[model samples]
Target: MESALAARLAAAPEEGIAPVHFVWIVAKDRASGTPSPMGIWSGDEDLTVTVALPDGTTASRAYLGGLGLEVEGLQYVADLTDNPVTVTLSQIAPAAQALVRGLDVRLAPVEVHATTMTGGALTSAPQLQWVGIVDEGPISTPAAGGAGGIALSIRSEIMTQLGQVNPAKSSDVHQKRRAAGDRFSEYAAVIGERKMQWYKR
Candidate 1:
């Protein structure tokens, strides 16, 4: 099933196309507590989706083009027909298809809020924790003795009571920017390592 989908995605044309993103809107049965897939949609809005790459990189950018949407073994894109520009999961790239198989793939970052710290001088600091993927299990049959693929999971958390600083203040703004730049550098290092791992495979 995944092979067929990969072929379709590889054959698709690239234009005003965007990467496909997914979310698992699990609705629990009020009576039995069973969860089920409800409504699903595709769009180019960055806020609506997020992609978690194997390298621990999370991007809202549509980097997959038309190839990211074609995933196999997922029921989310079985009968989509809203726009011609939209491609089904079975039509995304092979790597993406492999990642999406049986996984609730989302194209948005699961925000984690930082715990606040207070001092005697009434100082407040905001904290942030990036969401991490939770691997469920293998995607293949264990009896067949084949290596099964992993499933990715993500969830969002709110960080409240953040310090809202005035942007016009050069000293304050510079300090914040410097800190953010440092964090981004660290993130880039991790992402680079992940990319190396992916290529090695």
Candidate 2:
């Protein structure tokens, strides 16, 4: 739990604190597959704010677009376990539907924050209750004047990472990216095909 939030819970304030859920998705662009940051929260109005992340660091200020996104099946557990979560975007807005369909959201980083609202505003830093990756995204398009939705299936981040195949390549360029002076892979390509006579007949 976040330090401020834990203290608030311990204090047991008189004022009511409403629970709110916030989601941060690292979505990707359609064409370039470039990363795009989208912040969403279950609130009545949009907000630009920063919050504490689970990695013991402060996140950059995020603009959370509200009133259209929904999160489901989120759980907080004290044990070491991971579960999948689902996120859906209502298809009431055409632009939202288009945006969902246009992006390549596979393996996108997903984070869900749980916090409280006091006096119509967020309390302290929200605690990161769940972390995952986008396993798949399915969009449903409706007919003329019908309502559909875009749903994202999220799975455990550690599980996803375990299943991911390393894309590292054995080449000079790729090796240089890891360490500028490394030349271990310089002759990797040429040595593979080079023939050597090692027998004395």
Candidate 3:
């Protein structure tokens, strides 16, 4: 059910794209630990990014590192293994600090419908609808004079959600990623819609 990331981004307003956020939930079928079409399982109020480190002594530290947490006894170490990093976002800290790392959780396709209000333009723009998942999280830097922002890598959920529909394309890696992606994407779309809707309306 994942849609094209390129398509969605293209539809987004060039300006005022900041303060973006996506909230997601575990797919219903996935909630039961089985594979099925993606379904909404929860709301967006209480979702947190989970960072799992390698299964060793470095695990806990690695987890803290991704959060950009600087504690007395804990030193942040970078672990880049193709996965997106996780950070606890806040009002003041709109993004995750740079250097922390995490994996991108893949998922099944979920519908996304977004509405925007352009500065010069008067009325809210038409809703941009699509199906996709955020393959990665955004990488943020220092407030002024830094990487302006980060873009989530989104792709067609159908590209990977092939287990129950077509058992032939059975790959543990893809399935796991698909599930994660689904959870991430669904929440993202839902969260975005809710957040923007009030403003646009």
Candidate 4:
């Protein structure tokens, strides 16, 4: 089986080898509706998740979190499937706590248009590049630490046939345009500028 690291790196194109950047756009505050900047931080903690497979078995996995990556890198990581991803944040700050108080965060990093840990040589360090929605909740501590941070669990958007994107249907839609001979009309307009740019290429 392919290693998780291999799987994530596979998300990027062969030519992409730039440094990754982690970003988090804290959802707008419930009271003010104002969002937080994509705060970048080092010394991020590891991400762990418990995944239940199709068969009668379960597995626990971990990945590097608290890091950022551009869109290209993020896309690669987001392609990961069949497993749940979760992140744990330590040392909560008052301001950040406000943002995390009650919100589903958006992992919208910057665009990558162009583009871990200790122990021994055998030590494993995986960097998280996946981008998606995550559920957040507060963690309580009974120790003298007296404070804790939020834990983020990746929310899979996958669905059954009813909700899945039909590639064939998309192909048919594009083919219809091809058969239209590139004619533009008031009734037939295309939005999604980014997708249009890709389709044009």
| lDDT top scorer | 2
lDDT of 2 by residue, 60-174 (tens): 6554564467778886677656567988877655445545666667888888887777666677766777788888788788898788787888888886677679989889999
- Report the error of model 2 at residue 156, Å: 1.2
Candidate 3 ranges beyond 4 A from true positions: 1-92, 95-111, 116-128, 138-144, 162-201
Q: Model 2 residue 195 lDDT? A: 80
lDDT of each: 0.32, 0.75, 0.31, 0.40
What lDDT is reached at residue 2 by model 1? 34
Estimated TM-score per prediction? Answer: 0.19, 0.65, 0.26, 0.36
Scored by Cα lDDT, where does model 4 land? 0.40
Off by over 4 Å in 2: 2-4, 7-17, 77-82, 142-147, 162-201
Clashes of each: 16, 0, 22, 6
Relative to the true structure, candidate 3 has a C-alpha RMSD (angstroms) of 23.8
Q: Which pairs in model 2 have colliding backbones?
A: none
In model 2, the number of clashes is 0
TM-score, model 4 to reference: 0.36
Ranking by lDDT: 2, 4, 1, 3
